[model samples]
Target: MTDTVADVTPEIAPSSYDAAQRRSDAIWQKIESDPSGLRMLTGDRPTGALHIGHYFGSLRNRVRLQQAGVETWVIVADYQVITDREILGDIQGSVRELLTDYLAVGIDPERATIFTHSAVPALNQLMLPFLSLVTQPELERNPTVKAELAAAGKSAMGGLMLTYPVHQAADILFCHGNLVPVGKDQLPHIEQTRVIARRFNERYAGGEEYFPEPDALLSESPTILGLDGENKMSKSLGNTVMLRMDEAETLKKIKKAKTDADRQITYDPEDRPEVANLLTIAAQSTGRTPEDIAEEIGDRGAGTLKIFTAEALNAHLAPLRARRAELEQDPGYLMQVLRTGNERANAEADETLQRVREFMGMVY
Candidate 1:
């Protein structure tokens, strides 16, 4: 939601969009019929605790993929976190706590592999050759990278930030991922990953296809903005509904969230971002449409809307919060989950790295 969408004045190809639509449609058409499932790569940066946004936007999809028998990889993107922050802060602490939330949210450790970025040294080994495949301008042109830097008020882009797309390419290619479940903001990253895969296969495969060009499987997730309605829900922005927030705290934050003076509940996203955001939260949590929620409220005022929204969010998050707490109490068990996942991830990544070495004639 916070991503800065670039102007598409130059990309005015009708056939290109037509082709893309067909490809995207084909991917979803057999999602249920196909039992083999996809090899998916997705996760969060361990900057802080995840919130409702993370749950709906990503974690929910991760759980679904795991249940569908997909080979899912959940990355604690610790390496990407350092690109923005000057200090490491409490990264290990954040990773441990977040892993608990991941498990509590239903990403079964047995099905989905979870690992930190730095822990997978095999991923780092692909960086050099992958970097060679991409041009500097392509790196600079990544819309997500530009948006992240601008949002953070950063004037100069760090080397890591500039090359983050390349790092992402490494992340996906290392695992031989074919489907990346992501929000609309992250589509471009997957497209970049495709480009990398194509380049590597062509250059090294000697007329054979070695890598599967990954496709973006966009989630049908409503864009959940922050309480301020001015930015995406972010823990650092102090405007997130934390996944672990107690009932009282969650209600308190919703009560203070921005709403208009119109008093009537309408899902107007453009003019009333705040009201639209609240409606989105309630509707998604309660399994109803925003229009339905608004119609039921029927001019009951923003107060009623806020209460309904908060209660719905609380109802949804209660079990999850409790589960996270229980997991947190048993650190040894949670650590075991992560360790097992890390081993799985390392083995997969190492296998891919060895293949790349053999293809490049470095296996002497």
Candidate 2:
């Protein structure tokens, strides 16, 4: 990847690209040397079950950080689900499914705190002062927010939607999470969070660092294109293989996945995106380069390539699927894991909130 990492979202200023690269590299180096000293906050909205894209993209990194001994917090962001949409579909089930995926993929709740956004009141409370620190122009300038609004076909941005980045800042700062794993599109959010942290410490704490301005831990994972081969893998599009899917189900999905007409298979993303996407999947599963996978499968055609990719993926995910099945059988255990994490997160949030109140003389 270049200095920009990937095709960055428009909200991130083009000028900040190289700077972000430098900062990301430096933070990653520090993490490698002293992983235990860092705190990381990263999560997803519990909208639905996770898929291969989520696995290889961010979830893998989350587990790696947790195993590396970083104090990790995975917020379900339940409240943010309604930021754009009016309806809240099966949040309870969604949260459970997300937890199952988390555990099945080696995210130890004992090591990483996994909690809901709604459960932590103090975390939400931090959003108030954080909202004050950022200006209206700054909020409107966020490309991700604008893109989301456009995607959702909403002419007017909701209050939560506009201040979404503020909520994110609170999520990170409330727990003193200084290392945030995010892709290029989310880099601007981390930058805005840093601005909020800087302004708060300067204006309220007399420039004495109260919040560690979080750094973006850029993900090196390639964007996993959907089975359609045209768009990014998305559940809504019916083009994803869910993590909970069994080996047979996954193989069936792969068999039906879109592919090119050319018989001679090669890894050329610009030209043969669909075939290359399958190769990428196989490569990620087998820990081999996509180019190597393509070379090995030369002239085998899409049928052979699909079967090869499916087998590799199934082999990689077999253990995770077995673990997920066990977790599903014991619903009580899953809830207990979530409840324990929520309690720990609330305690951490309370301490941070009390200190913030003291800093601003609102401790009455």
Most accurate candidate by lDDT: 2
Q: In model 1, which regions exceed 4 Å deviation?
A: 1-21
Write candidate 2's Cα lDDT for 1-364 as tens digits.
0111122355566778778888889877877898766898889888878999889988888888787778888888899888878989999999999999999999998788899999999999999988889999999998878877887777998898889889889989998889888888887788899999999999999889989998888898898989999887777789999999988999999999999888888899999899989999999999999999888888889999999999999999999999999999999999999899999999999999999999999987
Q: Estimate each model's TM-score.
A: 0.93, 0.96
The digit string of per-residue lDDT tens for model 1 on 1-364 reads 1112221112214564455556656777766668374688887777667788878877887787677777788888888777777888899898987898898899888777889888889998888889988998998887777877776688999898888878888888788888777655666676788888899989987857788888777677787888998787867678988898899999999999988898788888999999999999998899999989998997899999999999999998888988988998999998888788789889988998899999899997
Lowest summed lDDT across 10 adjacent residues in model 2 is found at: 1-10
Give the Å shift of residue 47 in candidate 2.
Answer: 0.6
- Residue 113 Cα positional deviation in candidate 2, in Å, after optimal superposition: 0.8
Q: Could you report the Cα RMSD, in angstroms, for every candidate shown?
A: 3.0, 2.9
List per-prediction Cα lDDT, in the order shown.
0.80, 0.87
- Model 2 residue runs over 4 Å out of place are 1-8
Instruction: Write down the worst ten-residue block by lDDT for model 1.
Output: 1-10
TM-score of 2: 0.96
